[model samples]
Target chain A: MAVLLLADVNDGALATDAVAKALSAVKGLGEVHILVAGTSAAAAAEAAKLDGAAKVLHADDAAYDHGMAEATAALIVSLAGGYSHIAAAATAFSKNVLPRAAALLDVMVISDVTAVVDADTFERPIYAGNAIQTVKSSDAKKVLTVRTASFNAAATSGSAAVEKVSATADASLSKWVEDKVAASDRPELTSAGIVVSGGRGVGSQSDFALIEKLADKLGAAVGASRAAVDSGYAPNDWQVGQTGKVVAPTLYVAVGISGAIQHLAGMKDSKVIVAINKDEEAPIFQVADYGLVADLFNAVPEMIEKL
Target chain B: MKVLVPVKRVIDYNVKVRVKADGSGVDLANVKMSMNPFDEIAVEEAIRLKEKGIATEVVVVSIGVKQAQETLRTALAMGADRAILIEATADVHTDIEPLAVAKLLAGVVKEEAPGLVLCGKQAIDNDMNATGQMLSALLGWSQATFASELAIEGDTAKVTREVDGGLQTIAVKMPAIVTVDLRLNEPRYASLPNIMKAKAKPLAAKTPADYGVDVAPRLSVVKTVEPAGRKAGVKVGSIDELIAKLKDEAGVI
Candidate 1:
């Protein structure tokens, strides 16, 4: 009974934390075989040697060039017979692709599994991580997506064999289009060890750069509240809340962010939370392990200097 | 073009869900229910397309118990032309998987033959984010998920998707599936006259079995537990104190 883990990759390299973390979660299942399905998967295949994986199956084709869910699902469904279980990181790609694969197999998918209770049972969060539920799959084949933030990334020390595979068939229903990604030098928000987030209190888009400077010094990712994103002070991807990306990094620094319940839903799981706001009554202070009642403008620069 | 939108009845977002003491599931007795917020967005988008003369008709569908008829009426009041209630018995053990739901919707799609299908990316309750993608797979239709903006031409639909980092723009031919994001548009409230008129609108009811799909869940809940809560913290007197706690105690820095 081998397990197949779908590696999330971008620009030819694999997601450093998501694949390994998903690999770590499924380590006890059996010999983990990885699937790198993409157009240019050579670099990702070379870097997919996480310690938990025994083999990396590489499937490269133009049909998968767009990362369309339909084609990817078809490719996985064709290979599903060899593995007892299939899994991937609960990222955008997995969210799009895994369900189609699961549906093709005529089974329910155990989404965003935080822990492996056994080969067929798993733990996942419901109601936006407010409640955890232990669910058992009755299907013959179990398909899963792992929450990247809940587990630690496995070490990249294994010498896994990389075997190139062919695309099963033509399942192209969508076409590739342009991707307008935000150019950022800082770490990606979801996998970053430390995240410094700003909110409406940051005032303007230009002033929001103050949070970036502090994050740069700490090598942290820059995040934004929904208010900041709605106000056009930051990109939509920067927003962290129930409606946005949920992150559980090691250290989360909230700068000028008043913690709404929705916002707290996303980052409350952080190991160490630090809130910086002039309003002592800010909701963020309630969850912060260390709360400082100070103006972000004056405090942030001082903290940058201290670092 | 005709637009078909699939909606869901979920616990009102304002109501705080409480886990059952016996580890069964979230208690919903006497709780207020409303249309899923994302589904409302989808309905709103479809209505806007109709108002703009781009869509000739808009049909709404919901799958749940008899109470879900109220949700379909709500969608009709919100400007859907017609409604279809695909019934499924509401019980702890009777829940529809995304695949089953998709298959049921595929039945509706085959009968309706709509040129465009607009649905929410995911219901807030389950947050599976699978129906639209799964349905598209079943129908062999082009799909655009997390659509923040959409504009339809004669045969092509241009969509702007809210991706992880930023946005991506894509073009798909007609008869495509679009799963709306929150940024698409704010759903308008049904006025008194419209609500009254919705009472008289034609609402047809059917069952999942009628569509040849079984709604029994493929996964069973073994247990449920409230997430660990974070305790109230203290205010740091100085930056030095904050740094000390982060480095010495938290060891995150």
Candidate 2:
């Protein structure tokens, strides 16, 4: 049985790290085939180079340009007959697309899979990572969304054969109007080696600059507690928590964060955690590898200058 | 136009869940249960649409145990016109799979043909963000997920979605599904007067059999276990010590 791995395309190129990480998860299941469905030939070229993939199925079409769930799900369903498993990176893009495909296929999707115990069995986090549930799917075809952070990215070395796939009929349900993504050279929050995150205690929107400056100094990504994002101190994409993006990096720095259980659910997997807050009794200190009882407003500036 | 909002009853967000000793599942006994936080935001958005005259009525639905009636009343107290409680499972620990829930909701949608179906992006309990998207697929409707800003314009909706990179704006035709994000709006608390008024509001109870959708589990739970906890680490005296430990001891930076 072969596994169909969907490759994520971004900015007319392959989302290399995301696709590689997703590939790592499915490679263990069976013969891995990468599906590159977008308006980019370069993305297909990139997918054809992933080491473990046996083949790259490329569908170059304008219908897939915006990555609409309807179009992608239709294409996946059209090609679902041959594969035993259909998988993609558990991201917002795939999160919106995969379940729909699963419903259309009359199967259940194992979302946010952290481990592949076997072809039919898997492990996933439930209750915001408070508990882990091992699930075994009984459906004929398995649909999955792989949590990219749990596995290492697949290296690019082997050359897999590229096969052309025809685009399916568009559902014509949604349209892309505009996307407002603030350009930043900093590494993405989910994959960064280090993440410097702020909380509501960081004060207003202007005071948030201290956290960003520290992240820049450390060459890390900027993140925020749900409180900081809800308070308008940070953008929605900057949120890192149970409801937002889950990140597991080499080093995670929490400044002024009280470490609510929801906040801890997202970052507890980091190898090293650092907490700086005026409140000595803050719960964040409990998990931090290095806890510094200090005011973030003053400590952040000093750390940035010294670094 | 009418708006349909689906909510879920889950363990309250404030309580820290504990895995049962036998590995069956999280201990739900004596646990506080409430409407999922994201679904609360969804109900609030539907009510706002009704108040703005964009919608003529707001209907809320929940598919779970009979006690989910409490969750529906909460939505009614918040300003929903009515509710439907589809009692699917008797066991509290048996969480209904998203595929079944979506199929049942599709049945409900066919019966009550609302112009829009608004729901939480994901329930906080299962953390399975699939129902709304699956429902859209079964019904063949447009979907705009992770919406931070949404406006109804003529026959279409202009939605600003929170994506991995940043915010994305999309135009979806009517009869769509919009799963709300946290920043959509601050959900309002039920007032004392509204709480009193909610008891008299219509709440119809049904079963999964009524919709001809089986609530059987397709995925078997092999085991449930607590996630490995992080060991407590040392507290540093100052910033210099912290940076030194990260660089020298941890080799992270």
Candidate 3:
């Protein structure tokens, strides 16, 4: 049996971190085949080789330029018949496309998987990252989405052979008219090693300056809860929850968060969780490795000062 | 222009769900249920549009059991013109997938032919977040997921979406599906007068067959289990001990 990694082209590559982690997680089980779907299949093939993929399946088409989820899902479903299991990074496109394909194929999809126990068994977070659950898929074909932050990006090898294959696109489906990519030079939240999140307790968007300061000090990315984003304390890009980006970082510092389960679903997989809240009994402390019971007004500034 | 808003009834956000011993599903015995918080935002946005004269009528739709009508009523009380409840006795809480629900909504859209469709970006319960996009795909209509801002032009709608990297602005033709994000708008509380008006408002009830959609579970739950409990660590009184523990035990330093 072979493990097929569905490479998302929107990120311009296999999301190297997700590939490395998935490859590392299932090292001894099966040969890893990285499938690249894009206009430039050769670029994706070269990138996949850097992640230690044994073989690269390149599906190049002009219709793929916009990264339409429907067309992408259709392609994956058609090609999925060959592999025992399919995996992709839990990015926005993967989150929207893969499950629909799995449902179309009448198979089970295990999402945001952090570990692979066996061919069919895996470990993933259920309630945000507060609780980890072990799952076993009984279906003949299994689909899984991996959290890129959980594993390291595969080191680049010198080169690999690429095989080009032409695939059909469903033009009848709706196409992406335009992509408004976020303009940011900072590390992407899903791939960041350190994340600093704020909550409604921050008061206003101006208060995010302090969070940004500390994040800059640690070279970390900034995140926010649904409460903070809804309250207009921060931008939606900074939001973290079941509806937002699912992230795993080495160090996650949550400031002024009450730790709602929905919010926890996004960042619970971090290696070290530190929560700072005036309310000592906040649910965030339940999962935090280091808890600071104080007003964020005082603690955040002091953290910036100390760092 | 008629506005269509789809709402879902889910466990109250404040309620802590417990998995059943048999792993069949979450134990919902006597647990309080409420309209999904994001759906409330969608309903609010539609009502605001109607009030602003951007829309002439607002129709609320929900797909679930009879209990879901309570949620539709909540929407009606908040100023929706009418309510339609698609009745299903099955455990929608378990078998409910986004695509199945979207297929049902597509059928309703065919009959209603509303000019605008709005839904929450995701329901707090399962967090599938695919119905709006799936509906858009099935209908071949334009879509704006995770919408934070929306404005209507002559024949198109401009939406600003909240994506992982940042904000994205997309323009889609009329009769598009727009999913509400958290920051979209603040939902208004139901006034006493509106609450009274909702009691007299018409609520039509139907079944899955009425819409000609299959509500089968495309994805089955192999099992539902509680997360592993984290071990409690000792609290140190001094920063030095904290530093020592961090370096020796946690290994961060």
Per-residue lDDT tens digits for candidate 3, residues B70-103, read: 8998999999999999886656455466767888
Off by over 4 Å in 1: A168-172, B92-94
How do the residues A1-307 of candidate 2 rate in per-residue lDDT, one tens digit apiece? 9999988886677888888999999898899999988878888988988999999998888888778888899999999999999999998889999999999998998999999999999999999999999999999999999988898989999799999998875757889888788899999998899999999899999999999999999999999999999899998899898888889899999999999988998899988999999999999988998999998878999899887
Q: Rank the candidates by lDDT, best first.
A: 2, 1, 3
- RMSDs, each prediction? 1.9, 1.0, 3.6
Better of 1 and 3 by lDDT: 1
C-alpha lDDT (0 to 100) for residue A200 of candidate 2: 88
Winning model by DockQ:
2
- Clashing pairs for model 1 are none
Fold similarity of candidate 1's chain A to the true chain A, as a TM-score: 0.95
Local distance difference test, each candidate: 0.85, 0.92, 0.75
- DockQ (C-alpha based) per candidate is 0.68, 0.87, 0.27
* Candidate 2 or 1, higher DockQ: 2
Per-candidate iRMS values, in order, are: 1.7, 0.8, 3.9
Better of 2 and 3 by DockQ: 2
Better candidate number, 2 or 3, judged by lDDT: 2
Model 1 chain B TM at: 0.95
Ranking by DockQ: 2, 1, 3
